[model samples]
Target chain A: MSENRPLILVTNDDGINAPGIRALIEVMNTLGDVMVVAPDSPQSGMGHAITINDTLYCNSINVIKDAPHKEYSCSGTPVDCVKIAVNEILKRKPDLCVSGINHGSNSSINVIYSGTMSAAVEAGTQGIPSIGFSLLDYSLEADFGPSKKFVKAIAQQTLKNGLPKGVVLNVNIPKLNASEINGIKICRQANAHWEEKFDKRTNPVGRDYYWLSGEFVNDDEGEDTDEWALRNGYVSVVPVQFDLTAYRAMDELNSWELK
Target chain B: MSENRPLILVTNDDGINAPGIRALIEVMNTLGDVMVVAPDSPQSGMGHAITINDTLYCNSINVIKDAPHKEYSCSGTPVDCVKIAVNEILKRKPDLCVSGINHGSNSSINVIYSGTMSAAVEAGTQGIPSIGFSLLDYSLEADFGPSKKFVKAIAQQTLKNGLPKGVVLNVNIPKLNASEINGIKICRQANAHWEEKFDKRTNPVGRDYYWLSGEFVNDDEGEDTDEWALRNGYVSVVPVQFDLTAYRAMDELNSWELK
Candidate 1:
């Protein structure tokens, strides 16, 4: 390995202007030549979706004044942004791809709904070492000071030693002061879910309408879960992969009669 | 279990008006008391997306004349429709929630990008037995006749023998005549991906734009994979679950030093 800097590609589900991505970009700048190709708008629950039905438009944007890194805002999903970056924008395959420093937690089952992690997963599918970072706070004005140093440390370690093949990291930082942060924990996604409740209403034209509302219910009491780590004020890092196969159940499923 | 028929919830990624769903509705009608709450428009690549950022609209529709099923057109993603149907529409947890008979194959990696599978996954999360059905063809005029009996059989089996907890089935029917089908094969999702190629172009004002394009590439040569089942003209049933944990890599990741 050369002593020279690594090439890092940074993107997020939150729009480029979101403070979360800005903080992530700042951290990446200290480690490598960073390229930013992120969505033009918030793409929060996009999962692994790509913009197959529309034309994509990407334009160079000047976000940080006098910063050497290049940035682009693309009219696509987070996964689309990664595809365009690797296949069209970037001149070479990046040494690493980091998505988010997102404004909300993607711990537990929420990872399935996350656009932030989807970007990282998309990179992993293309054989790039990647990590997606999220904070437990969802507010636009949420403080990111607690996460900066930890984010930098994780990114540096990942750059120094690449991740396992076909695996990406889903890191969720707790919302706390830097001094109060209880360090990092390698954890698994908790078995948690949103208990959905729809608020029903009638439109002005007498049509019934509803608004989706939910309460997060974490039933898993495992200490080695991302939810536990975040709840206890530690940054949680879960090694995630794109393969959806439940390998343990394969034999059982195969034994079932098809007729 | 009572001798009385089961109550089934039916939906699809394609809108309530799509011919593919209409055919599925017809097949499901013979099974039980079917209630359809599906999106009002096509949502092909919606993935596990939900309509959290917007208000939802669901109106009872009289789409199919003389059909003995309750149907509603929803202004939301497939996942959203499932949420609304379960939380607001249904009096109790459904015996079965079947999505699709979709116009395209959601076998292998396509499962991660499918709204149909998302609907089924959503139902599974709620402890409901669910399945997402798809055809190997993408034509709007594709025939569902060949796979109707198989689809009914699978749904009936799921209703009769409850799925092992926390699992949902992703069933893909090969596009072939009934007599030509080589029965069903319970399989695992193959290691497959789309080799993305962005179609670059210049707009009327000479700004560079792109259209996302790709070709499916199957890397797994295993005969027990979903890809192989489809290739051999057999219906592929992959038992899928939403827990995205890579358990084998957990220990290796835990060994990494965070400090």
Candidate 2:
């Protein structure tokens, strides 16, 4: 590791201008020399997608004040932003990569649809210690004040003690007053899902259309889950990895007939 | 279970007109009632994205002949298609939702970026037995002839015996002749990744741009991996799930100091 301040790369799924990323940039500014390379537009549910089929355009945007950090807006997904940041922008392998203070929760099943988590996962895949921060609130005016200290602490800790290889942290902060917020809790991703309800309507062209709508349902009653942590007004940090292999079921599945 | 033919929902990430989906549709027609609600345009690498920010349109199109399967071209992501198909199009919950016969392999880390696998995962979340099929080739004219029998067999088996809840199969057929191909192998996702190399170029206006380029690097030497199966010319069947929890690391992570 470098003797100077750690090089921290910051990005988010909620676009570069979102209040969430701005708050994150402010917090990360206190920790190290930061660089912001995020999407030009909101890419919330992009997952781990990269822009392979199209050319990517990135331009340095002057957004932050006094902070020596560089910022760029990229026309790509969150994963694409991370890849471009690591491979194109940064001079060396970053000491850490942090994504989000996402506008919404990516607590459980929502992780699969999250561009924020995917950026962190992309960083992890490239052997960088990373974390994706999110708030339980989906509102544009969601309070992120409670998360500032927690985000700084987590970043400082990760910088002091590096994470395990292939493991990145998924941090979800409960939307609460800084004083009312409970302590941090490291937990597992809860068993949860979206019960989809599409609102069908007739378009101006007389064609039927639909809008995606859903309600999150958390079924896991376990107290040691991210969902539980948020519910109790605590910041939840779940150590997440990219290996989707369900190792426990591998042997059982192997026994099944392939013919 | 119903006594009549099972209601099978077929879709893909490569758009409704892709040859891979056509091959899959052909195989599905032999087994049961197939309803295809695929993206109107290509959605490869869309991952688990849904059209939440925008409106979605699904138009019933007449494409294939003699199949008698109802098909709709959706203006949304792969996951969105599955959601609309389940919530609006299908009168009842489908027995199966099969996505892809994808133009490329969705093995290992590719699953993280696969719109095809996302469709399958979405179905599994809805408690429908699902599978995502892919070929080893990425060619538009990639032959699906050799794998049809195996695809039919697997779909038939899945229909006959339901998959465990929360588990969906990611099946990648080897791009080889039936005679050259070995049998199916139930495997784990390989610890593989793309080593990204951005192709930089200046546009007409002298602005710099990048084209995402990468080569798949398989570091895992495990013989039981999906990468191994594909390399050995065998069809790889990896039972995948939407749960992203790294269960083994939960306790260890919790031991970290929060203060």
Candidate 3:
């Protein structure tokens, strides 16, 4: 409720204690009053999932000692974290909501299965300026040192100039150092898909189980795509929308012979 | 994998035992060689979540005895079911994929948080012609008799015409008797969202917990929307696409002063 500073909400699919979120919190502290409410445990790949069938437990955490911003960890998905923050935790609507600084890339078709982008999109649906950040590295100890400046820059600019209505940004940084990065490029989501290759195993009880895994195939040869931007050593920023309607295909569907 | 019979894949957000999917199964059996792979437990509101962090158990279940179709129940989200079906179970890529005759509506804003539509979208990502169907009624005992004809009609059309690349269908039927209902309407997703209303409860141990619930709010008055079509007693079929890129906002985002 500070008059001088904007109220910024921070969350991520990675748990509150994750290094990626810690890096994000460090950047947001300079911008405004930050309220961090993220999952108590890692919630990667939980795309837009809410805790409807179960109870949620959210409590204050002392992740960083004497941190100016308050942080709460919840036992729910990323979308659940955002909903609870907006509905019950925050005194008023946040000026901006930022998610991720994810441990891995969420470019192209990965967005659909991304918990990071889903958190940002959920905030966007509530009419808040939002963005999701990710690094091409999927390691727990991924270098977030270089990402700080770009993250701060984008967040600062978003706070200064609001995002377009019904749109949120999906930003992906390359796995290179600050000097090697070609800088940010506003790009389109490349047409791609995950070629699923499940790892099947037999348990002690002689029953089979599967661990879901995949190979991301980016067939989109567009020079102006998120895949291209990231592969070419630039941070890719694709403005994402929640409206799923295929407006261009409505006319073709109308021609179907249905009664 | 007979050439004479089109290979159809059926799945739903509701468990394989639900009457809604049972209704869908009855209809699909008459169409092609149907392979039913769905969650063993109810997975409503699970969105596009995939089971990445945990092991998934999928087993053959005899839900409908000698029903002339194979049914495998998986302990995973809707998207996980689709992924497993395509990668581990199916002999070949499905000719078409159909999800749900969900016990509740997935119209308008519900599509984002809907496991039903997510299943269809997951299939669509792999180039399968897919559709998610739902009835306005949420009750477990809700009658699906009226929905059968329309479901068959739409599925048949999809198998014959095939969907546009990267597009799937989200169809919601009004909870009206067959005779009292109007015909199908090709529409766009209505702009709407859920107004969150969390119910806070104290546990016996004096710890606070919250149950996530919301009121569906649809303010979009456009007649070409799925909400409007459903309100007027028609089956609303919105051609939904997996591409979340906000093409219109790319230019505006490019204008941002972020380096």
Using DockQ, give the best candidate's number. 3
Which TM-score value belongs to model 3? 0.99
Q: Number of the top candidate by TM-score?
A: 3
Residue-level lDDT tens digits of model 2 in B138-227: 999888999899899888878877887678999999889999998999889999888889999999999999999988899999999999
Candidate 3 residue B156 Cα shift, in angstroms, is: 0.7
Q: List the residue pairs that clash in candidate 2.
A: none
For residues B1-259, write the lDDT of model 3, one tens digit per residue: 4678989999999889889999998999899999999999999989999888899999998876667899999999999999999999999999999999899999988899999999999999999999999999999999999999999999999999999999999999999999988999999999999899999999999999999989988879899999999889999999998899999998887888875
Expressed as tens digits, the lDDT of each residue in A59-141 for candidate 1 is 99998889879999999999999999999999889999999989999999998889999899889888899999999899999
Candidate 3: clashing pairs of residues:
none
Which has the better DockQ: candidate 2, or candidate 3?
3
* Runs in model 3 lying further than 4 Å from the true structure: none
lDDT of 2 by residue, A160-258 (tens): 888877789999998889988889988888988888888889988897888888888989999988999899988988888788776665666666666
- Which whole-number lDDT from 0 to 100 does residue A195 have in model 2? 89
Compared to the true structure, candidate 2 yields what TM-score? Answer: 0.97
- Best-fitting candidate, scored by lDDT: 3
Give per-residue CA lDDT, model 3, range A108-211, as digits (tens): 99998899999999999999999999998999999999999999999999999999889999999999989999899999999999999999999999999999
By DockQ thresholds, what CAPRI class is model 3? Answer: high
Candidate 2's C-alpha runs over 4 A off are A1-3, B1-3
Native-referenced DockQ of model 3: 0.87
